[model samples]
Target: MRIHQLSSAIANQIAAGEVIERPASVVKELLENSLDAGADAISIEIGYGGLNQIKISDNGHGIIAEDLPLAVAAHATSKITTLDDLYAINSMGFRGEALASIASVAKVTISSKTAHQEHAMMLQVQNGQHVLSPCARTIGTTIDVVDLFFNAPVRKRFLKNEKLEFQAIELVIKRFALSAPHINLIVKHNGKLVLSLPAAIHEQAKRDRMAKIFGSSFIKDAIYLDVERGAMRLYGWISGPNYQRSQNDRQWVYINQRMIKDKLINHALKQTYDGMLYPGRFPACLLYFTINTAEVDVNVHPTKHEVRFQQPRLVHDFFTSQLSAALQSDGQNNTEQTLQDDSSGVTSSFNSKLYDVAGEAINMAYSFESTNKTSDVGRPYRFLEESDERYESNFYQNKLELAEPLTSQASYVAPLRPLGSAQAKKNLYSDIDECSWVALNNQYSLVFIEQQPYIVDVLVLQQKWLLEQLQQASTPLESRPLLVPVRYSLSLKLKERIEELQHYIEQLGIRSEWSIKEDKLLIRSIPIYVPYLDLRLFLEAVADLQCIQISSLLELMSQMQRFDPKLLAIEERMALNQFLLKVQNQKSQFHGVFKALSADDCRMLLHV
Candidate 1:
């Protein structure tokens, strides 16, 4: 056999395999073409999850009768002409391969009537042949792709079930609808109306679209942002810390109006949201980033769902700063709003009754089992994927665990106790011989005891240390003034209840200021260890003091330990190392918490 150039039909089929992945891919390509043609109102009709037929009608600039043949030919495109055009792509698609590639795998009929033409022309193509004829239609375009993947058996077999496939297709349409809110979109599946979004040109109408898609609760919790710097502009709605989801399904972001999954963007957003949210929770966000087209290259990936920024670090920093400032400002505004209605506080009799509570201890052995978030920037639809693949990041790769005490913040004097030299280990733990600690996957720690190795949970150790520290309750907790006073809504009743528990609250190390005229409590001071504590939960602990145990107040301090042990930042790791060392110094006495493992168990752990 000799090497030879592949025929046009074979070449296009191979390209189709890359771009046209499933029914959704076909829908995406056709929609892009429609949008690129300046469509204002688009209609999509699907049958059998696009396996049987797909009809896309758009009122945009249409093809002329003379160019109907070339329109379906491979490499024929009006989007780009030279090498410079590829470098600065502004359209959703540039390569003319979409229509050609689509025709290679499906029966395609394209009908169009340009504004300059009195009559429309329709072209029907199948199996590398085409027929052109006069068509009666408006000044727009209609593409009907039938029998998708008809020429590609292997690709057809790789598709998911009909319902799942339709879901993926619907997701694509929704994305387009969001990016082009000014466009009117109507979709139908199996002759039943599925989605209909009328053109939204006003702010109120756009918000209506958002509420329809993400729910009214999302609108209630989300914050609108609009900021710009030089050639870059960032705008959209991001849910506050209180509104969160267990998964990233609601996170949608676009670059220059193109929806993409960029790791840089994800990392920046996650970094901006750090400390505000627990690692496991994801907030709902719909963001759009505007950058000069020439500054970002969108031709890097085959799917066009990724881009390369000319100045990635600069873009990342911009995203972080803007998000952080907006969120903080929003927090302050909500905290200071006035409430004028007057109401009496809780009854004095109710406040005078002191109750004792007995509850289970907080032993979070499984809290640190998995990293909360990944920087993969995954696809919008994961159910269509063959398997779930994880790509761990190197963003925190070079960072090492901290072995020193934490540095204090501005205008604060809280003692940061550092572990002493190896000689002073006697005070922390009564050990018989040499000992050391090794962290395992941020979940467990392996400590050596009398030359024997055992595993211990990191959270369990932290809790044990905290409980031991609280035994001598007379020692006052180190309190630090907050940079900005945190406000918690103080209802007339809750405020009275909190004032009654003033002694207990002070004992737990939270200081606040109460304004007689204002219905809010300003948290001016907090415990030195944790920078952020949930105000809602703290208030709950005060209100439910009769039911919540004595340890409940200190249990809220668990926010301090919410960090990835293995991927800790340089400074933070140093602080954690200091914390862990104390736990290590006293681990010898945490009897049942440490487990001895056989040689096989150790080997299995290492392999895992």
Candidate 2:
């Protein structure tokens, strides 16, 4: 075949194949164009699922009569003028391909009257030809398309059922209605009104619009999240932990007012709900993230449904941190968090060194140990019994009821006593040893200091100890290069996603290179704290995880410490006992978990 350039009509039809896949695509393109034209009031009329006709009327600044011919010309866009403009696109219809593409595949008529014009002008195009005349009566524009895909029989045959296409179009309209809550959108099907949304300029009106699209129940059970980090801001509503979805259909994420399907975003948000949700369930969220346009590339996808961030790692971490904090705090933060920044606060990075909280796991030597059961040691509050699984749940409730609050003021009456719920000078842990304590219900242990009684929650102490360990290290996890870079391949979609996550993966201590030409992955380094990647399956598993941190040795110790005394390995019990001895006299440290036995508490213990 000889090399040749395709005709203008043929080239437009090709672009149509990429941009207009279904009735919904056409609606999306036209509606976005109207919005870009600064339309606040738009009306859409669909017939036969857009196969018979699609008429869109928008009260936006209309095209000048002289530009009618250029308006339908492919590649002639008003949104961008130079390379720099392309990089920082602020308008939605920048490609200038919608009118041309729609014209090539269907019969299109554009009618408009500029505000200064004496009369309206109309342009009609059919089968690669155009005609212009004077008509119409509004200061806005209306675009009418008929017999869509009439010139492309193959594309017509591939369309979905009319009912399904209409549903898809309805969904596109709903997206606009939600994203542009301040716009008035009216829709009609076969000349019957099906939907109407008035402009929502007030907070209450916006909430009402949300109820119509996502259901009132979602709003009732959702928490509002408005947080910011430098120039980036994330604000929206997320359903409470108890309100979940069977599937992730309700997860709506918009970047700078444009809806998108993003893997990194979904993954990070899902991670926030890991333990809060049940298996096979997903959380409902309506979130919007706004960032500088220059920091992201939106032209990578044909439909502009995905974006590439300049610093993906920073963006991902920012999302995870802000969302996690809001979700954890349940929109009412009781724990004040200090956000530490290394530079201008426009960015964030995750402390993957969290794995170092369990350091021995980096060596792949951490494993669960078993032991015999210990006898029930308390009334109404049973310690963890290997055979009695029901007690742990109830015991946690008891701990909350009995544990000392952190804000209790110290009493001058007992200068030697630690900050606790109550001071009992008669009992103190100042001279107690590990062997002198009795394992009590939940994680509490009864100990004797200076021959007096003092009670402490051992589990709480272990957690505090682990935190101190991490603080001492005060460094990021180490990454060790592999002797030979691991190589592999995956589906093209997964390949592209992982490549996009290269910087993020590196922040998790993975150094990798992805080759699009061959669809291969080359991994040169892995986080040192991740213990057992000495095998191929482990390597593959780690790569597929995208990012994972090392486990802290203390996590293992905490679990074992909870085992019934008899079920615990002798060495584990000895370790716990030894730790109890260390805290025997740490009066200032147990402000929240230590309780000196009152005369009444002692009397009850003796059953007197």
Candidate 3:
């Protein structure tokens, strides 16, 4: 194939494969452009899964007549020019590939008019070619994209169902809306208006806007955060400890007024929360960070959603501090009091505000009047006192209801009976004394030799089990002792200990020596029983064991050789079963005792 320059139309279509993969991608790109153009109010309309038709209208500073054609051309952007501009990029769509990419695979009509212009100009682009000139139109910009991916049959087939595609579009709109709380946004899917928000300026307004977009429940549990450290500024609302979602869809982070899915910030937020929250559950947050533009590179990606920060650690630390402070302040407040106070008057008042003007006007009129005043004069004073007394009684009753129960059925208790009990007295008089091992009511194991039961500690039994297993297994040690004497180097301290215990090691067929050059102790051989022992651990275990004086080395040998694998396994299983049974018995005992107490109390009340 001969090398030749590719045409602009072909190049744009190829770029569309990357920049405009689906309807959501197109929505994201257009929304970003609207935000960059200072759009305070934006509306999106989609039909037939954004394949048959899609329209995005923005009340922003519209493009001029000369810029209309360039806007649909690849690599044509007014956001940046010089090399230095790459580092200081503050616009959301600096690459200017969105329009060109969308125009390549769809029929696009951009009707735009600047605030200074008397009439708007419209340009129609089909299959990466301008089919119509700029015509007169209304103010602002209205972009209508129809038959998306019509030129590419393969891409069209990959498009999802209308409902799913509409959801994707909604997701993109949500990101933009979260990033720009001051912007009013409206979204329509198949002629149905799914979202509409008035312009939000104040914090409460922004919260209300978010509630309308997300849910009122989110706003209820949100914590406001605003803090600055050195060159970094952090501000936003985050969900409280008690508020969490199954996934991270609710988490939104924007850097330099551009929405980004950065993992560093997410990790920092999670770290602040620690393990107090459940795994896979994410805290809802809308975090915004502002840093010096020159200190960050925004040209790293085509979508401008990823950035390279000069000091990521600083950003992480700032977020961690702010989030921690917000959570700590929330913890200090009495949530019950706050919730009660809010529910009594504030929440009711706020809920009424969501209604129409007529309802709100009626609410206002009733809200200001003294609710305590009664129409009837004679019984008014008596009624007021009675109402006050009833309210006080109900408050106390509520407090009592909320209090923790003193005696719960779940508490654990021991099952053993006292010696003076009737059952113990009966066992004492029986032939249990002659039995070598008597099971205490089929519960406990008691060994008898001279008319007395010998009780063994459970922990001691566990240790014996481990020792038995070690003895029966092929020893996991390296060095084996030989009959012939072998010299080895050793440290001064080790040499002294070895000399003192030479007879002891010789009996086991091992030898050692002190080497001044190496300044260490070296062993020639180990016991035959533990031929593959770790030299260090074996020596340490021996030293510690030897510290306790015994009558004879033969006794020590017998003690070490007592471990047997089969017996050990049996012992361990038996011990585990015993422990499990003990725990169950104790739990049952607790329940029985609690039930008896409750019964006794009921009987006493009946007698009274």
Question: Which candidate number has the best TM-score?
Answer: 1
**Count of clashing residue pairs in every prediction:** 2, 10, 10
Model 1: lDDT of residue 318: 94
**Leading candidate by lDDT:** 1
| Per-residue accuracy of model 2 over 1-608 as CA lDDT, tens digit each | 99999999889999999888887898999999888888899999999998898999998988899999888999888899999998888888788888898999999999987889999999999987889999967888999999999989999999998898999999999988888898999999999999999999999999989888887556765778898888899999987664555468789998989988888898888887764543345788999999999988899877898889899989899888887887766634311211222122422221111111112111111221111011121111111111111211222222212112111111111111122322321123222342466776545677664466777665566545433433333234335565455455444444565566555556545577865664456666654332222222223223344334434322321222222322333333444444555665676766765677879997897995
CA deviation > 4 Å runs, candidate 2: 331-608
Rank order (by lDDT, best first): 1, 2, 3
Candidate 3, TM-score vs. the true structure?
Answer: 0.57
True-structure lDDT of candidate 2: 0.65
| Stronger candidate by lDDT (2 vs 3) | 2
Whole-structure CA lDDT of model 3: 0.59
The residue-by-residue lDDT of candidate 1 on 1-608, one tens digit each, is 99999999999998898888898999998999999999999999999999999999999999988888888898898899999999888999887888999999999999999999989999999998989999799989999999998877888899988899999999999988899999999999999999999999999999999777776656766788999999999999987865555467788999888999999988987887764554455677899999999999999877799899999999999988998888887866654331111112211110111111222121211111111122111100001100112212221122111122233221111123333444443443443234456778555777665566767665555545444544434434655554455444444556688788777777766787775554456666665444323444345435655654456666544522333335433333333344444554554686655676779998897999
**Which model is ahead, 1 or 2, in terms of TM-score?**
1
Q: Which ten residues in a row have the lowest lDDT in candidate 1?
A: 378-387
Identify the superior model by lDDT, candidate 1 or candidate 3.
1
TM-score of each: 0.62, 0.56, 0.57
Q: What is every candidate's alpha-carbon RMSD to the true fold?
A: 16.0, 21.5, 30.4
Per-model lDDT: 0.68, 0.65, 0.59
Q: Positional deviation of 187 in candidate 1, in angstroms?
A: 0.6
Give the per-residue lDDT digits (tens) of candidate 3, residues 163-199: 8887888788887887888888888888988788778
